[model samples]
Every structure is written in structure tokens, then in C-alpha cells.
Target: DQQVKQNSPSLSVQEGRISILNCDYTNSMFDYFLWYKKYPAEGPTFLISISSIKDKNEDGRFTVFLNKSAKHLSLHIVPSQPGDSAVYFCAARTFSGGGADGLTFGKGTHLIIQP
Candidate 1:
């Protein structure tokens, strides 16, 4: 079973608009949440992350929000641009889960920016 889930397979938005991507998780033991953006044939690149203790985190045009009680998380991108089009994956892990290779990942959402 997938602990992390991204229900929406894709989203499209106009340039300079905001893009929102959502994710859900089933594991309460997951204490860390992360979002990664990937281009075709390239590795997923770290985007933003939020800890269980924090409700939200932001960096430049990207932000991540976490609702522990609902077991939900979301990623928001402001001023969406054509270059921002990519596949975004939501991931989660426990601090003590052991090893650096352990992360439960969602299938990913493809974001398309229209000019």
C-alpha cells in the first residue's frame, strides 16, 4: 500500500498564476514531509519540506503546508511559469526509520504552465 498519495495526476495553469498540488499520507509515524520536482529524464530535485512540528514552510516561490491531524499536505507555487512545468512528488519518512534511503513517495503530479 502507498503511504503517500497524490490524487491529481496533472494540473494546468496560466503563467503568473498560482499552482496548488495536494498529497495525503496514511502513516502517522511519518514525521517529515518533502516535495520534489523532476524534469524529463532527470532526477527529482528537492523543493520544499515541512516537519511534523511545523505547519508550513516556504522558500521563494514555493511553499509546503502540513496538517498532521488530517494526514494531509500541500505544495503551492506562486507566479507559475512555463519553466515550472514538471512532475512533483510528495514524500514522507520517519526520523528514526533508519537509513537515508527510506522514503514513501507519491506517484507525482504533473504541472503544466500555459503561456
Candidate 2:
């Protein structure tokens, strides 16, 4: 079964507005979550991330919030611009003793920015 899920396959937002993408996970072992943005023919680039210990993390126009109790996380982009349009993937990883575990990714959500 898919451990991470992005219920909405696509989201459309107006320029200069706020765009919120939601993600849910079934794996309770996940302690770190990351969001990546991908454009056509381009590799996914890391955007924002949040640790399970923190409720929110913000960087410039991007903000990520994690709710460990609910196994939910969200990425918010304020003043959405045309460049913000892309496929966003939510990934989660469980930290082991030392080595890093592979990340579980959700089916990406496409964000469309409209003028």
C-alpha cells in the first residue's frame, strides 16, 4: 500500500494568492518530511521540509507544517507566482540508528498558477 498520499491530483491557484498542498502518511515511523518541486524535464528540487518535532517551518514564500499526531503535513506558498507552478511531491523518511532509510514518496500534486 502507498504509505504517503496526496489526495488532490491537481490544484489551481490565482497569481498573488496562497496555494496550499496537503499530504498524508500512513507510516507512523516517519520522523522527517520533505517537499520537492519538479518542472517538466527537470529533476525534483528540494523546497521545504519539517521535522516531526516541529509544528512549522518557513522559508521565504514557502512554509511547511507537520502534525505528527495526525500524520499530516502541508506546504503553503504565499503570493503564488507563475514559477511556482509545478508538480510537488511529498516525501517522508524514518531515521534509523545511523544509516538513512529510503524515503517514501506520494503521488505528486500539480499546482497550476493562473493569471
The local distance difference test score of each candidate is 0.94, 0.96
Clashing pairs in 1: none
Off by over 4 Å in 1: 97-101
TM-score of each: 0.95, 0.98
Give the alpha carbon lDDT tens digit for every residue of 7-107 in model 2.
99999999999999999999998999999999999999999889898999999999999988888999999989999999999999988998889889999
Error of 1 at 73 (Å): 0.5
Model 1 agreement with the true structure over 1-115: per-residue lDDT tens digits: 9889999999999999999999999999998999999999999999998999999999999999999999999999998989999999999988663565488999999999999
TM-score of 2: 0.98
Clashes of 2: 0
**Window of ten residues with lowest summed lDDT in model 2:** 94-103
lDDT for residue 26 in candidate 1, whole number 0-100: 97
Candidate 2 wrong stretches, greater than 4 Å: none
